[model samples]
Target: MASSAELHQRRSAAVARGVSSMIPSYVSTAGGGTMTDVDGREWIDFAAGIAVTNVGNAAPRVVEAVQAQVERFTHTCFMIAPYEQYVAVCEELAALTPGDFDKRSALFSSGAEAVENAVKIARHATGRPAVVVFDHAYHGRTNLTMALTAKVMPYKQGFGPFAGEIYRVAMSYPLRDGRSGAAAAAYAIGQIEKTVGAVNVAAVLIEPIQGEGGFVVPAEGFLPAIAAWSRAAGAVFIADEIQTGFCRTGEWFASTHEGIEPDLITTAKGIAGGLPLAAVTGRAEIMDSVHPGGLGGTYGGNPIACAAALATIETMRELDLAAAARHIESVARPRLEALAAKHPAIGEVRGRGAMLALEVVIPGEDTAAGPAPDAVLTAAVAKAAHELGLLLLTCGTYGNVIRLLPPLIISDDELDRGLSLLEQAFASSL
Candidate 1:
């Protein structure tokens, strides 16, 4: 077998330059919280494939279901020959997502597609063109979603001209913006009313807990306020739970934590236990607004992916992985807090459940001025963790937040070891 270095050389020649990876080591196998690279090195996985494999890398149920499904059938194209697995996954989504109303869902091949369809549904249902998003939000990389996204350097630099009528507003980032949740929401709503005219808005889309935008949890009352306002304005409130869905956030959906029921929810990532399945689930009326042939792709809801999703959801319930995520937070958050107390470079420790983060900053004496983002230090620490056999991921608009997205099923021993390596990495980097 080719070594990591050899594979990396081939990858450099073959893969597109726009596509990037967190690490160079090619994985041979993975299960629970650990992965073995082709070179025979074991790594404690803290990234969870950017929070895709919430059930772990090789969950038995997911594995068995996929194997069985591949044998039965791979793809019949749900658009052509609709299957039970597809409808079953949608049923699970309707039951699991944060809503008590009659709901419906449409499956897609990627998160971007789900977000796009959500916007399409909102527009079709409301007959409005304007979509409102937040600062530091990351919807996706597609043309419409790229316009919805707020970052510039890597995700959106020179990627325009993007879709129009997507308005960006201030998000309730308590660390940087000192306003309370209500105050922040008022400001955002004011901005929308003044600039975009809420009457003209089709949707107010946001992440329940911002993911690639630095795990920025909007302050208390922020989400609920936004949802309420969206409803009053006759705009669909979309919670992009793509990263925080499933058991990653200690709840089936993060919006539940805020006690807000979004009109539409876009989900992927952890939904199918690493399978390429995404969904746009919403109220029945809104979802039905589109024509019969509107919301589907050739590979949308493939049988194998749908089967994996069913197994993944079943495994989550059987294990009560939402509780497991809370357990992980109980074990990991205090340790992270202690590390922050020790290292001034750790400007903040935030996030919930297994989805936690440490915002790296340049230490300064003035506490009121706020710490400056230290992307260089963040990169160094991640590199150190990788060298120590711990896989880490970094994100944020500033590129300074070290996000920890461990599988909900990660064992205590693996979690502790990964945290220990993280501390050592910080020590070396700082």
Candidate 2:
């Protein structure tokens, strides 16, 4: 195994400069809440592969399922030679996703692909050309999704001539706006009505809990209000739960928390126990609107990925990981709140279940001046935590939010250790 420095040198030469990695070292093995790098240094994993390893890395059931699947065959391309695992995965999705209505699903290779398909389904079903999105939201990196995404620098800087008819509106950001859910919703609805016009809209797409956009949890009634407006306007309400789905938020989907039943929901990240799999689950009529040949890719639902997804769903059920996410909230939220109380730099702590964040801002009178993001301090704290063997991830449109996404299966002791390391990092960085 190469040393971290040697591997980084090799990677710089071989890997594209555009591809970014959060950590300095290369991992050799990972399970539960920690990963060991090539140098044999172990670091507690709070990032959870950016919430992809919700069932924990290499869980026994997922590993067994993947091995059995590989033994049977790796690729048959479901479009050509469909397999049982693919069907089974879809069936599970129908049963597990938020809405109780008769639903159908289409499998894809990434969250971005799933989102693109959802938008396609929406436009086809409604016979409308316009799509609605929110500020500080992240759908994906694909051209269409990049248009949907709000960030400019890293995601959409060079990518241009993006898909048209995608409209952006203000989201229900309580910390910044200090507006009630209804007021925020009214403002957003007014913007849509005045600019995009409800008649022209095909879909109102948003992250139930905005990911990459700082884990911004909408005000209590915000999501329900948006869903209601979308319903009244005859537009599809699409929940982009790509980062907050599959028990990451203490529910099968975050929309469930608000009791908002979306017409379509896009999911990935935690769906397949780290394998590349994504899905768009929604109403049957809407999904069926597309022609038979219109909705698949050659590698859309690979057998191995499907197998992993089925096993992952089963593991989530068997372990009651939704409850585990709640437990994580119980344990982590207070600590984060306490950290905020102690450090004036931490302007807010937001999010639900296992998905949480600390918005770093300028301390004291400057905080009152405005929500001035303290990106430098955020970078220092993340860097400190990484060097101290606790991996943390920073996000936000302003690049001033520290997000914690520990694997659901992480032990109490491991979580405590990570929290302590974070505190130390805060003390040192501040």
Candidate 2 to truth, TM: 0.99
Tens digits of per-residue lDDT for model 2, 406-428: 99999999999999999999999
Q: What TM-score, computed on C-alpha atoms, does each candidate reach?
A: 0.98, 0.99
Scored by lDDT, the top model is: 2
Encode model 1's per-residue lDDT on 1-430: one tens digit a residue.
Answer: 9999999999999999999888889999999899999999999999999999999987899999999999998998998988999999999999998878999999998999999999999999999999999999999999999999999879899989999999999999888888899999999999999999988999999998999899999999998999999999999999999999998989999999978888999999998899999999989999999998988999999898899999999999999999999999999999999999999889899998989999988887334524578889999999999999999899998899999999999999999999999999999987
Candidate 2 lowest-lDDT run of ten? 363-372
Collision count for each candidate, in order: 0, 0
Give the local distance difference test score of model 1: 0.93
Model 1 lDDT at residue 221: 94
> Which residues of candidate 2, in runs, are more than 4 Å off?
365-369
